[model samples]
Every structure is written in structure tokens, then in C-alpha cells.
Target: MKAAQTQLNRYGAGLAVDGAFGDGTDSKIRSFQSSHGLDADGIIGPDTWRALVTGSSGGGGGDSGLLTHAAAAGKFSAAGVTWASSGNCSNRNSTSCTSFDGLRQASADGAVTLRGASGCALTITGGTETGHASGTYSHWNGYKLDFAITSCLSNYVTGTFAYSGTRGDGAALYTAPSGNVYANEGNHWDVTFLN
Candidate 1:
């Protein structure tokens, strides 16, 4: 059997990845399973693994947010953060195939705010989690911002983001006479970038 913690982390859920199923990890796991519609057995299995990989079921991808995982699920400006986008058009080329950005957190509460910059006007990939006031943000410019926010004290917080993208117009244009391309199929929502 796998150490409970490993399974949880693998699924994109965040919880410190300590490799030990401690009380904190267990509670987090249960919360994650509950959010993802898992069994809540505090054990990682095939079904749970799938859910984790898909990032469609879980509590902020497990612990942190979506910006931390890419090949699986999951940007920036200021403080070394900037948004960037490239590749085939999506969102009418307003969002792009990928975007990069970052998030800022309130020191007192850890509530995070984010923004990004990119080249693509359309978005080929993007997603957002309306945290019960805490979660992450993924922009199609090849960027993801994560945090646990109950409330953002400031009107506009500041932070940084990094990003990149593939070369193609995405699924819609796959047959549109493009040399070679693919959409950002990755789930893009696994861990909370709280840290």
C-alpha cells in the first residue's frame, strides 16, 4: 500500500507532501475526497487517482491550488511576475493557448490576489476556483496562481508570474490546416500555490 500522503500529492491535492499520513494529512485528504466526490477513506486508489489527475474533483486540487501542477493540471508579473501567451487562438485570441501570472497574499490572513500578461489575445487554456474564499487562478497564457483567500484586504494585491505555450491553434483548429499543434490538454488544476 502506498503511504497515504504520496497518493494525495500525486493527485494534485496539496498538503505539504510529507510522505506521512498524519492527522493533518488525513483531514486534508478527507476534505479533498469529499470535494472531489471521492470515498473519503483517506486512502488513495485508482478512482481517486483519476479524479486527482483530472482535477475535476477535489478541494483546491488537494491542498495548495491549480498553478503548481502543469503536465497534470495547472503564471506572473511584479515581484518577478509577468503574463505571456502564444500558440493557436482561443477566446478569439484574447486568452491564447497559454498564459503566465502570479498571486499576492495578505500577510495577516494569507488571502491571495493575482494577475498575468501574455501574447495571445485569445485564451486556449484557463480556469478559476471560487474558493470558499480560498483557491487558485489559471490563465491560458501558460500561467497559474494559487492561494487560500478568505478575504483580500487590499483592492489590488501584487505579485509575479511566469508562462509559456505550445505551437498550434488548439482542438478547434486542429483540422484547420495547421502544421503541427495540440491544445493544453493538461488538467491545469491540481495544487493551490499558497506557498
Candidate 2:
């Protein structure tokens, strides 16, 4: 049961990972089964276990080269960024609303060919919450991230940054290869990877 919980959480169930197959875990299992075209019996039998472990469902592999939640939390430096708690904005509505993969991809884009001599870093300030009115739909699906440019090669602007044009201090919006949108939100950047 402990192993199952761990795997489910790792597979993006957003469960507590407490090693107990309580109601919450059972519900998540049923959802996973339904999505994967299984019997949806809320059972962790061989097939379900295999899917959870292998990420056979469409949700496991990142959109492109983005990192998984565990990978992002464990190896943020490799992605050329640092994680900071956004006060109440970190997990405003729920912790599960924040997409770790979205953060990883946004950070990767932010780090690309930095213009200034300083090492690039984006301090995450908001993710998946209602504290900010500007977020709206982007943050509602656990696919949006808000981060500020802590350090950069130059005074990063919306238009000059990679993957986007210009939107002044409002937002430099750019669509990624996977159709995810990244925007500049004044003091921070908002990434919406919901495709």
C-alpha cells in the first residue's frame, strides 16, 4: 500500500502519499482506472499497478523535455532556476493546482541564451491560485506558473526574451512548441502549459 501510494503521487495523483489506501487514494485509483479504460474498481491489481508504475496513461510523459514533479523539486538547479514559496500564492487554492512540469519548462525557456553576464534565475511567486486576479484561467488547471526574474544577463523585457515578442511590462506572451503559453506579468512571468 505504501508503494502504491508513492507511485500514485509520483504519477500526479496529488495524494498525501501517506502509505494508506484510504478513501482519497481509492478515489484517485478509480479516476486513474477510468481514464486508462480499466475496470475502475478502485483496485490496485496488476494492471493498475503496471499503469501507475509505467505511466502508461497519457499524463506521465511531459509535453516535451520538461521534467517531472519529483525531478523538478529534486534537480531545480539543473533547470537553471530556483524555487521560492510565493507566500500564500504558492498553493493558494490547493497544492495540487501548481504544475511542477510547467515551472520546469518555463524556467528552461527563461534560461535560454541569457543576455547578461549574470546567471539567470526566476523566483517563483505565484502558481495555481486565486490570490491574483490577473491569473484567471491560466492558473485554474494546475498549468500556470508565476515567477520573477531574480537574476538575468540584462534587464529582461517581454519582447526581447526568447519564445515571446513584446508586451511592455504587462506580459510578453509566447506560445511554446506544445502550444503552451508563457507570459510576462510585470514583476513575474506566468507560464500556462495547458495543451
Candidate 3:
């Protein structure tokens, strides 16, 4: 069970790997099963275990080719990224703070790509903390991040990436070939980093 929890965390489920099959672990198991095309019955049976171990529905491959997991702010800083918050909070447990725990590695890599490509100073204003919309691939779930806007980033994202039209809130959208989505949210770019 501890291994299962660890594997789920590797897949960005964010469950505590304490070996306890609690509600959070159960929910993450069900979500992983559903996403991997197994039965979402919340049962850690053979099929689900296989999928969890291999990151695939069936057997054959070692991993699903999607590398993702939780990371800290220092990891981002080491990657040449910075963060800020309007409320000036830095605590991860605080809703008003900019948190990065459970932030998908792919998301951080995407930000690195953006910073390198744009040659701009990228400041992340939001992360896997609260205050964003709720969804399966939401900020709280580690799939999304919010980057503070700058003229250089604006020009690069708009000019370099392909425009995918505007979002529901009328924010201009851009998509990179790596399957990451960027929405212009006025003061920041709401980026959804996909694997």
C-alpha cells in the first residue's frame, strides 16, 4: 500500500504515502484507475496494481512516458524561475501564499522552457495553492500554474506560440507543441501544463 501511494504521488496524486488506505488514498486510487482505463471501484486489485506499477493500462512498457511529481520552490529557483504573490504570503499551507508543493514536474519544466525561450524574467504568482478554480486538472491538483505577466513574456507567448483563440473569460489563449496551454488572465498567464 505504501508503494502504491508512492507511485500515485509519482503520478501527481498528492496522497500521503504513509501506507494507510484512507479516504484520500482511496480517492487517488479511484482517480488513477479511471484515468488509466481500469475500473474506478477504488479497489487496489491486480489490474489497478499493474497499471500503477507500469503507468499503463496493460503491460509491456515501464512507464507511460509522462514524468510528473511534486516539487518545491527551491526546485523552481534552481531551474531559473522565481515566484511572487499579491498578498505577500510565502507559506505553502496558507491560501494567500504562493505554494509549490505537489507542483507537477512537467509544469516546472514548461516554465523553464518559457523562460529560456522568451529570454525574460518569469515570476510565478500562483501555484498548487488555493484561490484558483477547481477541476481535475486544476491548480490545486498540480496541473496548473499562474505566472505574473511581463511585456517580454506577453510578446513571446503571443508571438511564438500558436494562438488558440480566447477563453471563456475572454482571455487570449496560446498553446505550445508540448501540449501546455497558456491563457492570458490580465495580470498573469494561467498555464496548464499537460504531460
Sort by TM-score, best first.
3, 2, 1
- For candidate 1, the 10 contiguous residues with the lowest summed lDDT are 104-113
Highest-TM-score candidate: 3
lDDT of each: 0.32, 0.53, 0.74
What TM-score should be assigned to candidate 2? 0.40
Query: Which one is best on lDDT?
Result: 3
Candidate 1, residue 12: CA error in Å?
Answer: 9.3
The RMSD of every model to the true structure, in order and in angstroms, is: 15.7, 11.7, 12.2
lDDT at 114 for candidate 3?
Answer: 70
Local accuracy of candidate 1 as per-residue lDDT tens digits, 1-195: 244555544433345765666787777566556644467897767766665455444445343333322212121111122222344322223433332222211110111112222111121133221221232222222223322221220111111121234324231111112111112223221222322
For model 3, the superposed segments whose C-alpha errors exceed 4 Å read: 1-71
The sequence of per-residue lDDT tens digits that candidate 2 reaches over residues 1-195 is 878877765434557767777898888787666644467898888888886675443344555434444434433332244556534323445553443533333433333222121345555555544544454345534456666654351244333435656556656676655565667665666666554
TM-score of each: 0.30, 0.40, 0.62
Residue-level lDDT for 71 in candidate 2: 39
